[model samples]
Target: MLIIEGLTRRYGDRIAVDDVCLEVPRGSFVGVIGRSGAGKSTLLRMVNRLADPSAGRILWEGRDVTALQGRALRDWRARCAMVFQQFNLSGRLDVLTNVLVGRLNAVPAHRSLLRLWSAEDRAIALSALERFDIGELAAQRAEHLSGGQQQRVAIARALVQEPDIILADEPIASLDPRNTRVVMDALARINREFGITVLCNLHALDIARAYCDRLVGLSAGRLVFDGPPEALDAAAARELYGLEADEAVDHAPALPGPTPQVAPFALHA
Candidate 1:
């Protein structure tokens, strides 16, 4: 379980997070949505310790994560995984090698940087690929794979790390419709099968309603709304989206892709 209390972050005189408090239980999926610069990514980064909160405490399981250092910090980090919007893979390396690098946190730094993975590491990497159903692309270089394939490889890498929760920062923002569904489906399956908690920042309400169990909305660095997707009606959407809603939806095409597996949902665990 993850517990955040009075979470806050500020840049000089500007406040990015304003005493927001939340709890994520084990094996739950939550989505965050808002216009640009909503501090959604900032909130996730704080949980992973990528960005420190100026004032607050993040409790993982039962320990105060903010107080951890050295080995403790490293171990805490290993349990939280991050997936980037730009698929941050080493394009020069083969897909298999890229996923194998996920084990780096547990390996010696020198060995990890040199890419001298052990035989056991190789097995772990292969197993992750199989889990994602992308083992066939093992030998292919990262740049050679399609966007969907690259994202899948990234997921496999995260899986190999044995993370408890996945923090995706606008993961599908750059993908085409087809690839978008592929990547989103992969995330959904991981959440269902492996019970990996998911905290995703998304731009589309439709996607949030489809895949996420809960929705947290931010506007101008403040928490404006938090509830189930179905509860966020057109009126509430207008408040969050502002006067641009009509123009935005008018331009949105029905993106072609596999319809996501909607299920009985609950607040973030």
Candidate 2:
């Protein structure tokens, strides 16, 4: 379980996130919805320790996450992987090398700097790529792949980390409708198949409502609503997005509910 207590982030006199508290049960798929600058990114960053909270306590499975330092902090980060909106792949690197970067936590600094990846690690990276249907592109440069393909590579990289929790900060914000479905489906499949807890920040109401088991709404910096997707009625959406009744929700047809069936990749001994 993940426990967040009195989480807050301040910039000079302005508060970005205000004393928000939440407890996330393990293996739950949660989507964070809010307008621009509503602190969705900040909240996820604090959980990942990419950003420090001015005041708060973050606990994971009874351990004080906020107090970890040096190697311990690095270990925590490795366990709590993050997927960013912009696919942060090295354009010059091949897809396999990019995915192999996830194993840096276990690689010695000298070996990592020399790009001396072990055969077992290479097998694991290829397995991840195959899981995402991008195994054929393993040797291709990351810059040559389309946005959707790159994002898949990013997900593959995160998977190789073997994280317990995935904090996705608007992962599909830049993709088109088709790729959006593909990416969201992959995330859902990860949660369903591996039981990894997902905390995704999303802007599209339709996507969030369709894929997430629970919806968390924030406005201005405070959490305004937290419940199942059906419980988030028009009124709550309006207040969350500060939109007119008709404009509050995205009325687009919902994405297909079934998780995508990509073949699982098994590691070679």
Candidate 3:
């Protein structure tokens, strides 16, 4: 389980995330949803330790993730891989080499710097690509693949890390609707097959409801709502987006799914 206690982040006078507390059960898929500047990205970044939290305690299996440093911090990062919206791959490098970078923390510094990857690591990288149905592109440079393919490659790289959880920060924001479904399906498959925890920041409400086991709604840095998709009613929707009833209706797309029986959670401070 992952526990986020009083998690907060500030920039000058502005608070990016405010005294938010959330508990994520192991192997669950949680989608963080809000407007563009609602601090969704900052929240995920702090969870991955890519950004510092002003005041908070991130505990994973009783260990304090917030206090880890040096080799310990590097190990924590390796255990919690990040996938970005921009597909952070080396454009000049071949797909296989980019995927092999995930093993850098496990290998000696000299081996990584010299690109002397082990045969075992090469097999692992190739297997990850094959899992995502892109093994044929292993020799192609990352720059040449289409956007959807590139995102899949990014997913493959994250998979090779053997992470306990994936922090996907607006991972599908740059893709078209068709590609969005493809990428979301890939994430779902990973969570289902590998039992890896997934915390994703998403903009589209329908997509969140369709894929996530639970939805976490943030409004201007505050925890506004937490619940199963069915429990997110019209009032909660309005609060999340700061919208009137009419606008809220328009914003929530009609998607078909069974209404989960779980109840909605109370708002946080």
Candidate 4:
């Protein structure tokens, strides 16, 4: 379980996250929803210590992560995996090699700097690639894959970390309808089969309501709501996002910017 208390983050005069407190239980699929600056990304980054919290305690499996450092910090971070919308893969490296990068906690950082991953690690990465439906692209450069395939590669890399919790920051920001279903279903399957906790940042209410077990709504850096998907009704979303009842009418998911595409998935319990 992940417990957060009094969490706060600030950048100069701007408060990014404000006194947030919440618990994310194991095997739960939770989605953080808000507009551009609602601090959804900041919260997930803070959870993995990629970004420091100005003040607060992040407890992972009963251990306080606020005070961890050096080997301890590394160990704690190893138990958590992060996925980004951009995939964050080495464009020049093969997909299998990119996945193996997750094992950096076990490998010497210096060796990683030299791009050396063990044969055993490569095999494990291949297995993950197969599971994510991109095993054929294992030897291909990351930049060579399509957007959907690239996200699959990213998921494979996260799986390589063997983490109990996965934090996905706008993971489906650039996928088509088919790929969105593929990726979200993969996450759901992992949660159901392996009991891994998934905390994701989603822009579409339809997507969150369709896949997530619970929804967390943030407004202006403060959490406005945290409950099951059913709790975030059309009216509640309008308040959280400053959208009119009609404006929230047809939210679509697509690459950020330009005309936002309507979400393809039908929302249901």
TM per candidate: 0.88, 0.94, 0.91, 0.88
| Local accuracy by lDDT, each model | 0.81, 0.88, 0.85, 0.82
lDDT of 1 by residue, 36-74 (tens): 787888888888898999998999888999998888888
Residue 220 lDDT in candidate 2: 83
How much does candidate 2 score in TM-score? 0.94
Model 1 quality (TM-score): 0.88
User: Could you say which candidate leads in lDDT?
Assistant: 2
**After superposition on all CA atoms, what RMSD does each candidate show versus the true structure?**
4.9, 2.1, 7.2, 7.3
Give, for candidate 2, the lowest lDDT window spanning 10 residues.
Answer: 244-253
Q: Largest TM-score belongs to which candidate?
A: 2
C-alpha lDDT (0 to 100) for residue 55 of candidate 2: 98
Cα lDDT over the full model 3: 0.85
lDDT of 2 by residue, 182-246 (tens): 78877887888788899999888877889899999888889999999999887888888875434
Question: What is candidate 4's local distance difference test score?
Answer: 0.82
Residues 1-269 of candidate 3: C-alpha lDDT, one tens digit per residue:
99999999999999999999999988999999888789999999999899999998999999999999999999999889999999999999999999999889989999999999999888888877877678899999999999999999998888888888999999988888767777887788778767889999987777788889899999889999999988888778878886533332323333433332322211111
Error of 4 at 180 (Å): 1.4
Ranking by lDDT: 2, 3, 4, 1
TM-score of 3: 0.91
